[model samples]
Target chain A: MAVALAALIQDPAAPPARHIAVGAASPIPAAACWLVRKAGANVRLSLLHKRRGNPFTEGTRELFDLAGQGRIDLFFLGGGQIDGQANINLIGTGDWPGSKVRFPGSFGSAFMYMMVPRTILFREEHSPRVFVPRVDIVSAPGISAPGVYRRGTAQALVTGKCVFGFDPARARFRLVSVHPGETAASVRAATGFDYDEPATVEDTPDPSAEQLALLRGAVCDEMLETYPEFCRRVWQREAQERVA
Target chain B: MDLLQLDALASLVLDGATVALPPDNSLPSCALVRALIRAGRKNLHLIGVPVSGYASDLLIGAGCVASIETSGVTLGEAGAAPRFVAALAAGTITVLDATCPAMHTMLQAAEKGVPFMPLRGIIGSDILAHRPDWKVIDNPFAPEIDPIVLLPALRPGFALFHAEMADTHGNVYVGRRRELATIAHASNRVLVTVEQVVDFDLLDDERLAPGTIGGAYVDHVAIAQRGAWPIGLPGCYDFDAAHFAEYARMARTDAGFQAYLQRYVYSDAALAAAE
Candidate 1:
């Protein structure tokens, strides 16, 4: 997942994102950002939760200021419920004020989604409950109406099962590729929203041995400052060695 | 301009006062929060700069907050803030859900003495749809451009937080956490709890001067060692993971939450006496 996200960050179609910001509770995106940086991409990373490598001294206020000023190039966001239109729901399900199921409040998802040019929607959980018909609440809209001064829109949606490329023109998600052991039919069945698919779907390419080596090496170490538990759980051997 | 006792400092915030707490993982004055809970401070309108976690949840569970204005409240890696989740589900407390930058921009408006601050994002979000207080206006600077959302200035009655250190003169060394400085600037009154009270002037030291909030902005200072206990204090310490996880677990039920309060908040005095 980190390798796939890294490829999106390094995609040639998008501008060379000089400044990338990763929000709190995002371990995979943080790893991908670090992996890209370690891969020799000259990018400045602003990790909101990082205690050691976070360059912002003023907390998330600096991140917001930079984003408002059009300084940030790339960002990552996730939602409790995402629909085919790319609308996301982070507030909760059921009614407003009194929700049946409550997720965490929308922190800066809407704000960053509008400001950053390449906002990647990454949610590891891929199921009908997550990919909804229409989100219960739109924390951030996937596409804005005409005349809205949004700098960007959803670039792509990366899930645990497959990757879906978003089309801003039509505001729809297109099946990009499925991960290993997953089929296009499985993705279609799990998803609640409608999307376009090709005649044949390809498996997401595996990261080269070199990329894997880099991810397990310096990238894992960089993740220690903010996401120690994630690193410990994912790269247990490397994390234990660091502790030792 | 010297350190006040915990109770004395806590008394500065009255019932029904709008209090501004620092963001998540920053310097939250847990000691002050305990003191407030002990005093039975009620009907508080908590303004979480952008986000809050334990402090807000503890207050809500104790029936202290009447309304809360913030983006979100969570334990981060630990998990969901149980009490807050319950409150929302019960509709017991009024929630003014805000986006992150909107909170900062509102506070910045107060800090700058402006009536309102206009922002670019949130036009198409459900947050704007829910907040009737927020307005969208045509960009007067460029009529050709789309409308922008304007948020009213957020001027809280009191700003409360914990810091790493403060000098006897009441100047606080917030270090790189400049949002604390902004909180002080925006609030009508500022009360700070510190882990240490140093004898030397913070401004005299070149390293700390730039990040220091002058005593003029600070109304009171209290020395509460590890004031952000359970919650981490940046360079000072790491969060008690076990404690937070326990809180997340125990706060799931009302009876369990009460037990937590009895153990931590009510027994604070006994724990302090033992010390």
Candidate 2:
């Protein structure tokens, strides 16, 4: 929610008609509510840094209503894998002991893919396991066909290494930019699919002056500075997981 | 006594047996299902399970159950799996809003021959109000009325289930979150129908699910192909869309439901087996 709050404040498309509703597979109502307010982004805020829980309560219906009524700006979803055109596949497997690990995920992925015009795909983990060739299942749709989007929806795929925005003209993921400390070749090598290696995938635009100002003054110091306990519980589990 | 023979799988439930049922929820289907439905007696109960489809509506209409004791979630009820909404509305089914775990606990108490089991972090105020049948005695220590909800045990004559595959000797392997465990614990006798009867050696470590119900617990098992009929397995067949919609429509009226039972369930067993 802190990051969502900050993302909203800094959004070039602030005061959006859709009101930047935060959709999650888990409950983060407070954080979701915070995104509507203007206080958080007063620094560079990254949503990935936060620890969250299972908020899965069929929240897809809310988004469905918004889409049916033509009231959506950007819906963000995190996936386990994404390909050239930003199609996601959250269902795991292609190997041994794989059947056991189907992460409970967005039941509305199919609906969202067809409806929400603009979607942001975030893959928290960046490795071969994700970033696959074609997905095991078509969890979300991207530029499946040219002019497929009757409404103007963009699906920007963000990974731990880089951020790739889609281009319907090519009907593939044209590199809009890369995150700090990433190279196009490394990302290309890691991908499971075939795509033209761009001459140079540009660096991801730095957080704007306004966004930075908001993050430092209003967001980082005032909020996230606290909540050490929630953060600890998460990383502690993660550490134990690593050891086990 | 171990009668879960492959050749007799179809005849086990359909040929003759008492059965307990959950309204609107489902267990896997078996191949000789149509014959079973035709041959099956009319004496059903509305217990609780997670999902229900055409088979449930047919069974209920067929009059295969006479009693009911329920506390389990339905498909479309609060925070439920969104599949069985229509069946719920059609009244061919019955369910109350409660967790499957709670239902299991209540039914298990019945199987263990208890009056009512007392313990809870549940019994929301709203749920307590609707269950007029449940009694609330004194808490004794608490000043307030006994805040606990008393779930009477449900001892069904027998429970039935279906699965992907089994062996000649009636070992059942179900997919995840299945009610097989609860069924095993709750029934006076248990019957099963499975897709294929694999060789005994095929029950490998990888193939076996964690909560495997023992043969000691199972009274009967029968092997059949396409056992999960009528109700499509998620990844298997495309659902029988027309049948579902038809059941939803017909189950609305008592006459329509009775007609359905006569045509689909209470027919001549000899003709049904031939058909």
lDDT (Cα atoms) of all candidates against the true structure = 0.87, 0.47
Scanning candidate 1 chain A in windows of ten residues, the lowest lDDT window is A235-244
- Stretches of model 1 off by over 4 angstroms after superposition: A237-244, B268-270, B273-275
State the lDDT of candidate 1 residue by residue for A27-113, as single tens digits: 999999999999998999988977644577775699999998999999999899999999988889887743778888899987889
State each candidate's chain A TM-score: 0.95, 0.63
Candidate 1 CAPRI-style tier? medium
Worst 10 residues of 2 chain A by lDDT: A51-60
Compared with the true structure, what per-residue lDDT tens digits does model 2 show for residues B57-128? 454455443433333222211122222222333443344433333455566676678888653323322234
Give lDDT for model 1.
0.87
Off by over 4 Å in 2: A1-244, B1-18, B22-26, B30-36, B50-53, B71-101, B110-115, B119-146, B201-211, B234-238, B250-275
Residue-wise C-alpha lDDT for candidate 2, range A111-143, written one tens digit per residue: 444455555666656787777776654444555
Supply the global lDDT for candidate 2.
0.47
Candidate achieving the largest DockQ: 1
